[model samples]
Target: MPTLKELAKRPERLTPGHRLCAGCGAPIAVRLILAAADKPVVAANATGCLEVSTTIFPYTAWNIPWIHSAFENAAATIAGVESMYRAKRRRGEIDEEIYFVAFGGDGGTYDIGLQALSGALERGHRFLYVCYNNEAYMNTGIQRSSATPLGAWTTTSPVGRVLPGKTQWRKNLTEIVAAHGIPYVAQSVASNWRDLVNKAEKAFHTDGPSFINVLASCNRGWRHEPSETLKVMQLAVECCIWPLYEVENGVYRLTYKPKEKKPVEEWLRVQGRFRHLLAPENRHLVEAFQRYVDEEWEKLLKRCGEA
Candidate 1:
């Protein structure tokens, strides 16, 4: 394993010329994951913020070998790439140690690409699938996705007189991926670079398939200032809305245990998506969101044997 200092000095895999939104978190996730891998990496990215932004016509920001997969088949596409690598290694066609990584947004991972991701995990491909979850279809528009939080306003699930932001709760993608019983599974946040890099390293070194779901804050979708991306992600951890944890070979472990669990409101306060919850009439909705976070955190604690 390379020391953090060594990793810090590694050449940038994703260059800086891309046109991603000023505060988009997906690029940060990509850079950290690429930096963590000790071996050269071949990446497959779903058609989302990362792909469209990084690859504009003939120009590309990626310095590594990268594939732009369809919105719903990044996992399957990367699986095939890994399969070819294995076959070539057996035939002595390629002798280098290379790593495989796949990136997808919450919209692609939580809904459209779920089946492909599941198949790849169940088949035990030697690759890492990372979901930079911004909680909605941020690339196309601020539309609702399964990963969108409850009571959060989106274009599809607006705060109309008919109902609150979104009636359904956010999908549990990390747990769902863990259910495949793969070698590694993790829930990371973009702000926690060290934690995220460590998980990416483990994912890279794991013998079998691995999955990581990162809470990628979207400046446009979440309606926050560009500079607030890291702060937004930190609040998510502080409030226990997005816990830092991992499951290795079916055993759950909590990587970060907050000394004081701040209320979820702290997280909601920054983003305009949850602004409606600040109203007196919608106070119950915030309470409901808080209850959901508390319950989920308690469940995670139990799984990690901290209950």
Candidate 2:
């Protein structure tokens, strides 16, 4: 595995001069995984902000072979490509090593494409599915998705007089993927490029299937300053709102744990999505949110055998 310093010198598979918004974490997440490969990589991206922004009809940001799959089938498309590559290899039509990676947003991965993803994983496809989770249908008017955190305002789950925000917690996509019993599954964030690349390498090396859930925040959707994007992600990890962990072959291990866990309020305070929760009237929402985070953190620690 390459360290951050080493990876920094590698040629970026995803280049700049694209339309992705400033401080968007999706492109960074894509670059990290693409750089993690030891061989050539064939990439597929689901229809979302990443694809639309990077591949605006007349131009492209991807320097490698890339496919723009539909909103719900990035996994299936990559699996088909991998299957054909294997067929060609068997027939001696081609004899070059290439890694496969599929990129999807939370809307595509957590909700729409989950069945396809599950099928591909169950069939033992040798590919890595990377969901750059922005926590909502960000490209589509900031609608809520299954992966949206509780008490976060979205177009679909607006905080009103009757409702606080999303009525439920964010879907545990990593644990859900781990349930597929694939060879590798991990939860990561783009802010931590080293950890993200390390997991990407493990996924690419696995013979069967692998999945990584990356926190790719949206400055516009989350209502945070563009410059504060990385800080917000770092706070998420330090606050235990998002723990860094990996599950390989059914064994859970935490990749990054804070020496001193900060309060979840530190995370919530930075995002406008949770601004309403800070009000005195919605005080219990904050309390409930903290309780939920604590419980989930403890559960993850137990899963990793740290408790």
Which sections of candidate 1 miss by over 4 Å?
A: none
* Model 2 quality (TM-score): 0.98
Q: Give the CA lDDT, 0 to 100, for residue 81 in model 2.
A: 95
lDDT of 1 at 287: 92
* Cα lDDT of model 2 by residue, 1-307, tens digit: 8987888888888998988899999988998888899889999989999999988878889899999859999999999999999999999999999899999999989999999999999999899999999999999889999999989999999999999999998878888889989999999999998899999999999998999999989999999999999999889999999899999999999999999999888899999999999999988888898999999999999999999
Lowest summed-lDDT stretch of 10 residues in model 1? 1-10
- How well is each residue in 99-194 modelled by candidate 1, as lDDT tens digits? 999999987899999999999999999999999999999999999999999999999999998888999998798988999999999999989888
lDDT of each prediction vs. the true structure? 0.93, 0.92
Clashes of 1: 0
Per-model TM values vs. the true structure: 0.98, 0.98
